[model samples]
Target: MRILQKYLKGGISSHRYKQYIICSLLALFMVGGVCGEYFTNCSSLQPGQYLCTEVNIDPRTQQPRGCTKEGWAKVLCTSAPGIICTETNNGTFEREIPCKYTNGYSYETALLLSVFLGMFGVDRIYLGYYAVGLAKFCTLGFLFLGQLIDIILIATQTVGPADGSHYVISYYGAGIEVIRMDNMTYRMPQEDWGVVGRGIKEL
Candidate 1:
């Protein structure tokens, strides 16, 4: 009975630690000024598809004219002159992303990677914090200062450098395939043997 009790207690402790780790990561992402729910999370466009039509609105007649991906053009709005509906993610251009997030990068992996690498500022570097990342690594994590801050920020979901004004990536691979939202046109993904492009189902 004593042995069983000890085993149960250990299991409980492990579970608690797991939860704590998850909470910490989300916190860091939030602090990074990259907390976006609309564009970041699963893309709004479908895979293997592209917008073919363009929409235009008539201010005088209070009508909308637009085109669809099927090469069929139509009005911008029906009766609602002030409202217009146009495709947000046209899925015309492809994007390139690291093959790790959904495939393997999990809460546990993130925790371990950020902690050990923060000492060398490796995580920051991935986010394009080249100078800071280099400085932190050189300072040995600011004598552990950098590591501590990284932990807190990471826990609070605040460890990002912003993906820019366009293509907000809010969620992982969920609603849409490998999302690639960008205001400007982008070339098709053809790196590492055409693994990345238009939309990746699982690559």
Candidate 2:
């Protein structure tokens, strides 16, 4: 009974730690102006280098007309009338990311994808479980029973990426601080893998 109690306590502690870590990261991102959700639209475009789309608003008709520029530019437009330029992140070009950060496989994303693709083992494969993922794929998510179990595990953060690295969700062209444990020690499962982007420079 004591052993079980200790195990439960450890598990709770670990979960809380991870939750706290995520919260702290979000807070830091917000304070540093590197928050990703805020950068999705034109209004929240950070004042840095970006590939902008030239948007011209007709003052008389209030209609928008513009063309995508083929190059990067410094955004200097506010919410004014007439012609204005907006930053584009259409994935065609790589612009400077103001504050690049890393994010793990979000519970919400995993949950949503699990509903549609879990039965076919696509979600497991996405999370990097190769052998078991292949098994589930072959067995149709173990005839759906395995999918149910995986859904629960993912929701509870019990099953993490098989590579032990978190997913990089908010990546700028530059480097930022990597995620660390509560003790300020790096938790990278492997070298040159856990941090965000192709070549992560730890800060």
Candidate 3:
């Protein structure tokens, strides 16, 4: 009887700890996920925040060598030909925005994903949107009126349906894949959908 009681008590303790284990896991995920989003959101050093906006600072003066004040502006970005704006405030540091320029995927793939896998909301998930994925799944697409917004969003990088920071769809996924806008090929990876080595031109 004593031995059986000891085993029973240990099992009970384990069961009690199981709930704590689950709760700890949930807490860790919440903290890690929140920290990830907060740091990444404010990390953007881009100026003007729009493709049409002019550089917030004068490039020559933007650096400490010349003028651009710390609170004033950090970097000069002209949605001009290149993707340059980087650095927060008037600091001398900057990092180029990835996927800001064309990277790779394809209009056709996004169209196909929307047309075929849309009902599953896999299309939105593939676009790096989890909440949208849940929402579309919930309405059974009775909310497809949202499709109009989606279409325009897939049409151009500039057309942000939701907060761009929320949807970091990898270049290898949906969105524009090597778009040949205005005779000039975009600066995106020249590969087919998710294919490995073959370049679009060679293939």
Candidate 4:
């Protein structure tokens, strides 16, 4: 009874510390599962590799699975076992690629274009919103109010590809198994951090 009391009052572990640790880890995992987004670039990946964005940094090593960040805007990604790297003219290379998609239509791309050319409706046209692009172009982004709205939308991710497909930012590594998302707003299918797959949206 005294041991029980101590456990309840947090006075002693009574071998319960392991259980406490496990519960804490479970809670952390749950939180991590819900907050699923990570920022990365896909332009650095080889012609066919997709970006794997879901890799979590290990708390102990401060490293992600098969990935290392060498500098700002530079990530070195290593593939898992059984996949082979090849010699290339540029350097050593591996070429397990995913289905190609337009990299220029991604969220980051849209944000960039919107920042520079939204007033001219270039961003809208880029995302395949041709009619709206025309209107925005003629009206000068609805006198710039519409441009402001688009900026907010793209930043928030409430917008998506003009094809109405959802964009899912997932990590794709050479020789790694692919995980597909359904009913998403956009799909950024590459893994190199410099390139992105689709358009931006509000929220």
Clash counts for the predictions, in order:
32, 0, 6, 40
lDDT of 4 by residue, 1-203 (tens): 66557787999775786687678777887666543322223334443344343344433323333332221222334433223334322222332222223223455578888888999898889888999999999999999999999999877767766875333333332212235677865677767543333322321
Candidate-wise lDDT, in order: 0.47, 0.54, 0.47, 0.57
What TM-score would you give candidate 2 relative to the actual structure? 0.32
TM-score of each: 0.30, 0.32, 0.28, 0.34
Looking at model 1, report the run of 10 residues with the lowest lDDT sum.
75-84
lDDT of 4 at 171: 30
Best by TM-score: 4
- Give one digit per residue, the lDDT tens place, for model 3 in 89-108: 22223323332312233345
Off by over 4 Å in 1: 1-111, 165-203
User: How would you encode candidate 1's per-residue C-alpha lDDT over 1-203 as one tens digit per residue?
Assistant: 55346556784476666676688778877666455322321223343322423334333212222222232334221211121233333222222221212211233333465687888987767555688789988998899888888877655555533331111132332212334568776888657645555347564
- C-alpha RMSD values across all candidates: 30.5, 26.9, 24.6, 21.0
- Candidate 1 achieves a global lDDT of 0.47
- What lDDT score is found at residue 121 in candidate 4? 92
Where does candidate 3 clash, by residue pair?
A: 74-89, 103-188, 103-189, 104-177, 105-177, 106-177
